[model samples]
Target: MVWLFAIATGLIVANLYYAQTLIGPISRATGLDPGAAGLIVTLTQIGYCLGLLFIVPLGDLLENRRLIVTALLTTAVALLAASMTSSAHLFLFAALCIGLGSVAAQIVVPFAAHLSRPETRGKTVGKVMSGLLMGIMLARPVASLVADAFSWHAIFVLSAATTAALALLLRARLPQRQPAGGMHYFELLGSMWQLLKTTPVLRRRAAYQACMFGAFSLFWTCVSLELTGPYFHISQTGVAIFALVGVAGAIASPIAGHRADQGKSRSTTAIALTLGAAAFAMPLLIHSSRLVDLGVLVLTSVVLDMGVSANLVTGQRAIFALPAEIRSRLNGLYMALFFMGGALGSSLGGWMFAAHGWTGVLWTGLCFPLIALCVFATE
Candidate 1:
C-alpha cells in the first residue's frame, strides 16, 4: 500500500510540472507570446493553489477514494485537451485544470497518513513524499527527453493515457474512506482560517517549509538559465542529465522521517535549513576551471534538493501528528502556504538572474534558508 500510494502520488503530481521545462516549445507551438510564456507554468501553479485551498479540504468531507479517482480523471481529461489544442488560450486553460486536478496527490498523502499507525505515521508519510519529490525532480528531464524523441504534444498525450489508467487502477484497489466530519463544504473551507490562527505548529512548520521551498525554487529556476548561458552552454540533454543527479537527494526523505519518529524533528529541521543555506554558499566560491565550476553547481543541486526534501517530510510529519479529523485541512493549508513561497522564489530568481547574474541568485536563495533558520531558532 505504501508503494502504491507513493507511485500514485508521483505520477499524479508529475502532471503539474510537465509544462515547466517545455514552456518554450509549448508557447511556440501554441502561438503564445514569448513575453507571456511564463503563464504556461504560472497559471498551472495558480490553479494548484486554488485547488489546495478549495478541493483538497474536501478529503475531510467526501469519500477519499472517490475524491482521488475523480480528481485523477479530471487531470486525464485536461491533459488530453492540452495535447489536442493549438490555441494558446485553450491550452492555458487546460494547464490550469491540470494543476487543479493534480491536488489528488495531496489527498493521497493524508490518506496514507490516516491509514498508518501513529508510531509509524512519520515514516509512512516520508516514504510517500519521497515519490512526490521524485516526480517533481524528474518531470523536467522526462519531458525534455520525450520532446526530443517526439514532439511536445506527445508528452501530454502519453501522460493523459497514463493518468487515466492510474485512475482506473486506484479506483479498483483503494479502500473506501468516508470522512467522519459533519461540516458542510463552506464550513470546512472556513475552518481552515481558524486552523491557521489557532495552530502554532502548523504556522511554524508552514513558515519553515515556505522558506526552504522558496530557496529550492530559486536555485532550480535560475540554474537552467545559468547552464544554458555563456558560462556552461549546456545543451538540453546535458541539463536533463544534471536534473537526474539531484534525484539522489530524495534519499533524505525517509531518513528525516525516521528521525522525526525518534522525536528529533527540531534538530532535523535545523540541519535541513543549514544544508539549504550551505548549498548556495558552495557555489559562491570562485573556481577558474569551467568544468570545476560546473561540478560545484552539480553538488549544489544535490545538497539543496536533500535539504528541501528532508525539511518537507519533517514538516509533513509534524502536521500529520495533529487530530485525524483536521489532518486534511491542515495539509491543504500547509501546502498552499509553502507553494506561495515557491511562486515568489521562482519569480524572484528569474529577475535576479537577469538583473545581477548568478551571484545575485545565489545570495537571494541563501536568504531563504537563513530566514528559515532564524525562525527555527525561535521554536
Candidate 2:
C-alpha cells in the first residue's frame, strides 16, 4: 500500500516537470522570446502554489479518496489540453492548470502521513517521498527522451492517458478518510496564517526546504541548456542518460527518513545543507579535460540531488510529526513556500543563464543552500 502511494506520487508530480527539459524546443515552436522562456517553468510552479493554497486545504474538509481522484482527473484534462494547443498563450494556460491539478501529489503525501502509525511515520513518509523524489529526478530525462523520439506534445499526451488510468486505480484502492468535523472552507484557509504565526517549527522547516528546493530548481532549469551548449554539446538522448545516472540520489530518501526517526533530523539537515552548497562549487574547482568535466557534472548532479532529496524527507518528517488533524494544511503550507522558492529559482535561472552563462547559474545555485544554512543556524 505504501509502495502504491509512492508510485502514485511519482506519476502525479511528473506532470509539473515535463516542460523543463523541453523549454528550448517548446519556446521555439511557440515563438516565445528565448529570454522569457523560463516563465514556462515559473508559471507552472505558480499555478501549483495557487492550488496548494486553495485546493489542498480541502483535503482536511473532504473525503481523501474522492479529493485525490478529482485532482487527478483535472490533471488528465489539463495534460490533454496542453498536448493539443498550438498557441503559446493557450499552452501556457494549460500549463497553469497542469500545475494546479498536480497538487494531487501534495495531497497524497499528507494522506500517507495520516495513514501511518506514529512509531513508523517517518519511515512511511520517507518511503513515499522517495517516489516523489524519483518523479522529480526522472521527469527531466523522460521529457527529453519523449521529446526526442516524437514531439514534446507526445509526452503530455502519454501523461494524460496514464493519469486518467491511475485515477481509476486509486479510486478503487485508497482507503476512505474524512476529517472529524465540518470545517468551513474559508475558515480552513484563514487558520493557515495562525498556524504559520504560532508554529515556529513549521516556519523554520519550510524555510529550510524552500531554500534547498530553490537550488534544486535552479540547477535543473539550466542543466539541459548547459548540456546542449559548447561545454558538453550533448543531445536530448545524452541528457537523458545523465539524468538516469542521477537517480542514484533517490537512495538518500529512505536513509534520511530513518535518521529523522532516530531523532537526528537537525544534524541530518546540517549535513544536507553543506553537501548542497558544495555540489555547485565542485565544477569550478575541476577545470580539466572534457572527460573530467563530464565526470564532474555527473558527480555534481548526484551530490546536489542527494542533498536536496535528503533535506526534503528530513523536513517533511519533522513537519508531519505535528498535529494529525491539520496534516494536510501543514503539508500544503510547507510545500507552497517550498515551491515559491522554486518559482523564483526557475525565473532567475533562465535570466542568469542568458545573461551570464553557466558561471552565473552555478554561483546562484550555490548561494541558495548557503543562505539556507545561515537561516538554519539560528535554530
Winner by lDDT? 2
lDDT of 2 by residue, 214-236 (tens): 99888889998999888789999
**Runs of candidate 2 exceeding 4 Å displacement:** none
The TM-score measured for candidate 2 stands at: 0.99
Q: Model 2: how far is 315 from its true place, Å? A: 0.9
Cα lDDT for residue 99, candidate 2: 94
The local distance difference test score of each candidate is: 0.90, 0.92
